[model samples]
Target: MDITIHRPGELTEPLRRAWHRAMDESPEYANPFLAPEFAIGIGRHRAGARVAILREEGEPVGFFPYERDALGVGRAIGLGLSDCQALVHRPGVTWDAQELLRACRLSIFEFDHLVEEQRPFAEHVTGLFASPVIDVKPGDGGYPEWLRGSYPGLAKTTLKKERRLGRDVGEVRFVFDERDPRMLRTLMRWKSAQYRRTGRMDRFARPWIVDVVDHLFHVREEHFTGVLSVLYAGDRPVAAHFGPRSSAVLAAWFTAYDPELRYYSPGLMMHLRTAEAAGRNGVTLVDLGRGDKEYKDWLKTRELRVGEGFAARPHPVAAGYRLWRRPVRGLRNTVLAHPRLRDPADRLLKTVGTLRTSHRADSDGAASGRR
Candidate 1:
C-alpha cells in the first residue's frame, strides 16, 4: 500500500472522480457533508487543506481529507468545524490505521463523531450522540401519513397549534425555495441574531460557511443541494430554514423565525413544510443534524448515529498527552452543549474573530459577512 498527500489545487480530476464514485458506492456514506464537494467547498477557503489518498495495487483504496493545525496536529479536513469524517474506502479493504497516520505525518489526530466502523483504529469507542431525522418518504400514505404514523401525538398537537395560530395570526402558506435570495439572507440574519442572543458562535459569521451556503443556494441538484423553506402568515415571513437536500435526504442545517411571531412557532412550521416538500419531492429522510432537541423525538421516525473523535498511536508520549487532553475535550464538549458556556465561547471567538472575518471578506461568497 502506498499513500500520497495532495494539496487542494493539486487535486486531479481522476482523484476527484474516484472520490465521488467511492462515496456513491459506500452504503454508510449518508451525509452530503462527507461528499467530495464538501471537502472541495471547504478546501477553497482553508489553507493547508489536503487530501490523503491511499492506494493498493495501484488503485485508490482510501481517501482522507484533513487539515494540519499548529505543530502538525491533524484534524478532519475542516476540523473544529465540518460535521463528518472517515476514511473513504471500498468494502473488504483492510486499512492499517497506523500506516495511514504516518502517511498523513501526524503526531495527533482527533474527531468527535467518528463512525463506528472506523473504530478498528482505537481500543475503545465511547460516547453516543443522537442526530434527529424525519422520514419524509410518502411511505404507504405519503408524508402526511408518515407524519401521523411516526408522531401521531406530536402531529396531533402540531395540528391543534396550527389551528390556534391561524385563528390568532392568519392563514399560513409554505414556500419551497422561494427563489428569492433576500429570504435566505433574512434567514441568515435571523439565525445570526439568534446565535448572538443565545450567546453562541454564529456560523453565518464565518465567510466560508456564508460562501458555501450562498453557493449551495444556487447549486441545486437532485440529492446534493441546499434547500430554503419559509412559512408565511399573510404577507409576513414567520419561520424559515436553510439546509441541504438530496434525492432521499433533506438535512435540516440551519433555521430561524421571527421572534415577534413566536406565538406561531414558525420554526416547527418550517420543519413541517420541509417534510411536506420533501415528501412531494420524493425525499425519504429529514436529518435534523446532531442534537438532543425535543422536536427530534417528536418528529423523528428513527435514529441514526454519526459522529467524530478517533484513536491515535497511543505511544507512551502520545498516550500521555491524550490522557491529559481527554478531560479538556470533554470539558469543551460539555460547554458547547450548554447555553451557559456560550458567552465565553463567543468571547474566545472575538480573539479569532478577525481572522474569521478577514477570511470571509477574501472569500466573498464563500462565507457569511459576520462571525
Candidate 2:
C-alpha cells in the first residue's frame, strides 16, 4: 500500500471523482461529512486540514481527512461538528494505522464518531456508543400518512399539537428546502441561545464555524447539498434545521426553534417534518448522531454504533497528548452514559446557565440605561 498526504484544496478533480466513487460504492461511506466537499470546506477555514490518499496497484483506494497541529497532534476533520468519521475506502482496501499516521506526519489521531467498520483502528477504540438514525421511506400520502404509519404512538399527540399550533399561532406550513440566507442566521442565533440555556458550548460564537456553515449552505452537488428546512406559522418561522444531505443520507446537524414556541414542541415538530420532506426528496436515512436524547430514542428506527478513541504511534507527543486528553473525555463519557450522574450534572449546568443569562440581561439593561 502507498500513502500520500495533501492539503484538501490540493486534491485534483480526478482524486475527488475517485473519492465520490468510493462513497457511491459503499453505503457506510455515504455521509456528507465524509465527502470531499466537506473536507474542502473545513480546509478553507482550518489551516491544519489534510487528506491522506492510499493507493494500491497504482489506483486510489482510500481517503482519510484530518487536521494536524504544529505539535503533530491530529484529529478528524470537523471533529466537533461532524457526526460521522471514517477513512473512506473501497471494499477490501486496508492499511496500517501506524503507517497512515507516519505518512500524515502525526504522532496521534483522535476521533469521537469513528465508524464501527473501521477495523484497522479497532484495537485503539476506547468505547462504543449507539448513534440513532431514522430510516425514511417516501410515501405518496404525504407527511400525515407517513407519521401515522411510522410512529403510531407519537402520531396523534404530535398531530394534535400541530393543529393547535396552527390555530393558535397561524396556518402551519413547512418548506423542505428554504433558500433564504436570513433563516440560516435565525437558526444559528436560536441554536446559540439554546446552547447557553443548556450550558453547552455556543458553536456559532466561533467565526470560522459560522463561515463554514454559510459556505456549505451554498454548496449544491450530487453527493452533498446543504438543506435548510423550516416550519412556519403564517409568515413566522417557528422551527428550523440546517444539515447536509448526500444522495441517500441526511445528517441531522444543527436544529433550533423559537423558544417562545416550545410549548408546541416545535423542535420535535421540526425533526418529523424534516424526515418526511427528506424522504420525499429521495433521502433514505436521517442520522440523529451519537447521543442519548429522549427524542432520538422516540424517533429512531434503529441504531448505529460509533466509537471514540485515540490512534497513536510510539512517540512522547502521542503519550503526553493522550495523558492530557483521555481523562477529560473519560469523565464526559461517564456523565453522559449514566442517568444518575447525567441528571445532576444537567441541573447544575442549567442553574449556572440561568444565573449567567440573568446577569447578562441585567448588564444589557444597565448599558441601555447609560446610553
Candidate 3:
C-alpha cells in the first residue's frame, strides 16, 4: 500500500468522486463528517487539516482526514464538533496504524466517536461508548403516521404541546431544511448563550469554527450537505439545528433553542420534527451522537457503539500528550456516566455562570453611570 498526504482542499475532482464512491459502498463511511467537502470546509479555517489517501495498485482506496499541529500531535478533523470519526475506506482495504501515523508525520492521533469497524486502530482504543441514533423508516403512511404508531405516547404529547404552543404563542410550524442565513446567525447566538449558561466552551466564540460553519452552509453535494433545520412559532424562531447530512444519514450537531421557550420543550420538539421531516426527505438515520441525555433515550430507536483513544508511534511527544489528556477525558466520562455526580457538577457550572453574568452586568451598569 502507498499513502499520499495533501491538504483537504487539494483533492481533485477525480479524487472527490472516488471518495464518494467509497462512501456509497459502505454504510459506516456514509457520515457527512467523513466527506471530502467537510474536510475542505475545515481546511479553509484550520491550517493543519490534512487528508491521507491510501492507494493500492495505484488506485485510491481509503481517506484518512486529520489535523496535525507543528508539534506533530494529530487529531481527527473537527474533533470537538464532528460526531463521527473514521478512516473511510472501501472494503478489504487495510493498513497498519503505526505506518499511517508515520505517513501523516504525527506523533499521536487522537480520536473520539470513532466507528467500531476500525480494526487497524482497535488496539489503541481505550473505551467504548453508546451513540444513540434514530432509525428512520418510511411506512405506508410516511414518517408521521409511522412515528405516531411507533411512539404513540410521545407523539401524542409532543403534538399536543405543539398545538398548545401554537395557541399560546402563534402558529407553530416546522421547517426541515431552512436556507436563511439570518436564522443561522440566530442559532449561533442561542447556542453561544446556552454554552455559557452551562459553563461549557462556546464553540462559536472561535473564529475558525465560525468560518467553517459559514463555509459549509454553502456546500451542497451528492454525498454531503450542511443543513440548517428550524422550528418556529409564526415568524419567531424557537429552536434550530445545523448539521451535516449524507444521502442516507444525518449527524445531529449543534442544536439550540430560545431559553424562554424551554417550558414548551422546544428543543425536543425541534428534534422530533427534524427526524420526521428528514425521514420524509430520504434520510434513513439521525445520529443523535454519544451522550446520556434523557431526550436522547426517549427518541432513539437504536444505538451505535463508538470509541475514543489515542494511536501513537512510540514517541515521547505521544506519551506526554496522552498522559496530560487522558486524565481529563476520564474524569469527564466518569461524571457523565453517573447522574449523582453529573447533576452536582451541572449545578456548580450553572452557579458559576450565573455569578459571571451578574458581575458582567454590574460592570456594564457602573460604566454606563460614569459615562
- Using Cα atoms with residue i matched to residue i, what is each candidate's TM-score against the true structure? 0.80, 0.99, 0.97
lDDT of candidate 1 over 313-363, digit per residue (tens): 645545765777788878866876787785677667665655665665688
Model 3 off-target regions past 4 Å?
A: 139-146
lDDT of 1: 0.71
Against the reference, the lDDT scores of all candidates come to 0.71, 0.96, 0.91
Model 2 bad stretches (over 4 Å)? none
Q: Cα lDDT for residue 39, model 3?
A: 91
Clash number for candidate 1: 22
RMSD of 2: 0.8
- Give the 10-residue window scoring lowest on summed lDDT in candidate 3: 138-147
Model 3 lDDT tens row, 114-181: 99999999999999999999998656685457669767878887878888899988998888889999
Model 2, 1-371: lDDT tens digits are 99999999999999999999999999999999999999999999999999999999989999999999999999999999999999999998878998999999999999999999999999999999999999999987978899999999999999999999999999999999999999999999999998899888889999999999999999999999999999999999999999999999999999999999999999999999999999999999999999999999999999999999999999999999999999999999999999999999999988887888899999999999999
TM-score winner among the candidates? 2
* Candidate 2: residue pairs that collide: none
Q: For model 2, state the Cα shift of residue 110 in Å.
A: 0.3
Question: In lDDT terms, which candidate is top?
Answer: 2
Scanning candidate 2 in windows of ten residues, the lowest lDDT window is 348-357
Candidate 1 vs 2: which has more TM-score:
2
